[model samples]
Target: MTQVNTFQLNSSKDEAQKAAFQLSAPQDDCAVMFASPHSGRHYPDEFQSLLRVPLMDLRRVEDAFIDQMISPVSELGIGTLSAVFARSYVDLNRSETELDSRMFSDGAPTPAGERSPRVEAGLGCIPRIAASGQDIHVRKLSRDEAEARLQEAYRPYHRALTNWLNLIKRRCGRSVLIDCHSMPSLVAGRRIRTDIIIGTRHGASCDEGLARTVENHFLALGYKVARNIPYAGGYCTQHHGRPLEDRHALQIEINRRLYMDEDTVRLKPGFYKLQSDMKALGLSIMNWAEGTRMLNSQRT
Candidate 1:
């Protein structure tokens, strides 16, 4: 067994009661919604003890500080929803149907539908492993228990996200959802790795123009931007993104090495600079969302 970082055999469901996601700087009728699905670090003392690995080791799979990087999005009058529970608890960016059987001690949970490759790869709504393939529990979970986790953590997060988008669409003619995330510095890329990878589900989720708009924003910053390469998008982009209906979605994957100490999970000297840059990035999207075209088309 991996060394337990914090051991608590008694973690309450109350931990799950904590809002899976948070909304900050809410503008009731904003055209754009920024979401940080991975930047949650509120590890309860009991939950921490249950981890079969060191706390630092468990964090290897986390998108540390992703919420903070995109936090400025709300200040620009855009709505930002961020998850507060670590991805190890429940992954909001994954499809509800993506549940794994291997992690369940009993048979797979009931109501399995639309199983995805992500589920097979161990990254599911109730993930069997963290983003880095770390096993979350020392023992397998019962199917009933798995379902409980999904119902408690995964379901409500999406509910909030969906409600938010609908509200924005009611106000604006349409809504744009930017699913924010961070990636490890290294991957098995065919060529040179990129600093940023923008996934729009091969443009099926968002209009090409809108996708290009975001790509150009990062490009203008002189950051290496790649489109639909190693990461083309995940469950949130695939499930929520609807270009034809005018609801656009894009997934932004920032390289973690850019701002954090991956080994120790600490903020690097570059953290503030990166946050500053992201603020500019967020502001640009806000300005674009508040443009005359979108504002004039709002459902008045």
Candidate 2:
């Protein structure tokens, strides 16, 4: 059994446990799935009860319109799984085990190991601080509350993701994952001039050739490109990527300023062009999948 068919519902009862993620291509037609874990914007009422800072402040942490940006890829037979619940509510990019002991009533479902640097910085699976460094909840959460978010949001999303990837592997002989995300144009008050950053976990997550090919696509499109600097991907890239199993995961970070007004959290005139470019990017991956499938047949 793969990671798929292994996770059981942690149901402390989330309102939309089954509906939190939307999978557009259940058929797995192209053997590629574009997932946007941080693009979710929905803030549940139960979550609203925990708010300390204004919601807009928390919104800054979102990948913003990345879900919509990757939506077009489904048209080309790439499965798309979009998390609809807000990342501030429960970051899907993080490990459910990455908890902050201080955030919970009983010191959390505390990690059995030392806390990771990101968790210490308050960016765990259940985030403690907003993008602006403001606290998210006014009070410490109950152990049940923390577990519910993990069970409801984190586990379900991964369950569906793993199942889909395994299915693609079984049916197509290869599986590809394009983990979609957006980065702020400015970090720590400095501008990031690169139009895109592609991360393959220093080639651990994917073959260097495929990573280079994807990077070259954006570069040929006149976009400045960077590799593994500042953002080298997160739990998703590290966990799902299994090159030995013929499964590859690559993370693409789009500069938000290229498509949206950051302060207002609204799309700019550039969003459409970028959306179009995303469709092209998906097509490129599909073409690669086809070629890879053909080569595998020859090898066999």
- Candidate whose lDDT is highest: 2
Model 2 sits at a Cα RMSD from the real structure of 4.6
Q: Give, for candidate 1, the lowest lDDT window spanning 10 residues.
A: 1-10
lDDT of 1 at 191: 38
Q: Which pairs, if any, clash in model 2?
A: none
Candidate 2 deviant stretches above 4 angstroms? 1-18, 26-29, 110-114
Task: Give me candidate 2's TM-score against the actual structure.
Answer: 0.92
What lDDT is reached at residue 133 by model 2?
93
- Models 1 onward score TM values of 0.86, 0.92
Tens digit of per-residue lDDT, candidate 1, span 110-203:
5654467777777777766654457767787777766766776577778878887888878777888889888888665443358889998987
Measured over all alpha carbons after superposition, the RMSD of each candidate to the real structure, in angstroms, is 6.1, 4.6
Model 1 regions more than 4 Å off: 1-16, 44-50, 113-115, 130-134, 188-192, 292-300
